[model samples]
Target: MDKYKQSLSTSTRPFSQPFCRRLMKPRINYKNISLISRFISQRGKILSRRVNKFTLKQQQLITIAIKQARILSLLPFIKFDII
Candidate 1:
């Protein structure tokens, strides 16, 4: 039992680190299409705070930017693969 437990612990992978520690500073803008696109999924849905690792304020800003960009036709409402 002790050996099995030890083996199990050793076989487990370490927790993954986030790709970017700080994605961006404050003052997120809607005009920055490139930056805003990063926060959106391939399916055209806005990514969550947990996935983006953003604070409450930052997440809210990102959501607003995405919507604004979509309205202005700067970003697509949905991404479709033409295959």
Candidate 2:
């Protein structure tokens, strides 16, 4: 392989330049069920930062929001087994 091609193949990380489009932040309100669900797993668990790519503050907000939704019966505490 040519020297230039070898360098291109080894670069996996995206450029540090700010994205043209920003990622949408999730709402902390209980009524924002749609957005909240995207940050949670099908098993009714909150997803981690690595998977969700949310900032520390955002993750904390999501955790509290999901808990509130659960308490209000807006979201499930645990998903029921189909089997």
Candidate with the greatest TM-score versus the true structure: 1
Lowest lDDT sum, 10 consecutive residues, model 2, at 15-24
lDDT of 1 by residue, 1-83 (tens): 99998998794644343434365544367889878999999899999887877667677778999999999999999999789
Return the clash pairs for model 2, or none. none
For model 1 the local lDDT of residue 67 reads 98
Residue 11, candidate 1: C-alpha displacement in angstroms: 26
Residue 48 displacement in candidate 1 (angstroms): 0.6
- Cα RMSD to native, each candidate? 6.4, 6.8
**What TM-score goes with each of the models?**
0.68, 0.65
Provide the overall lDDT of each model, using Cα atoms, as 2-decimal numbers: 0.80, 0.75
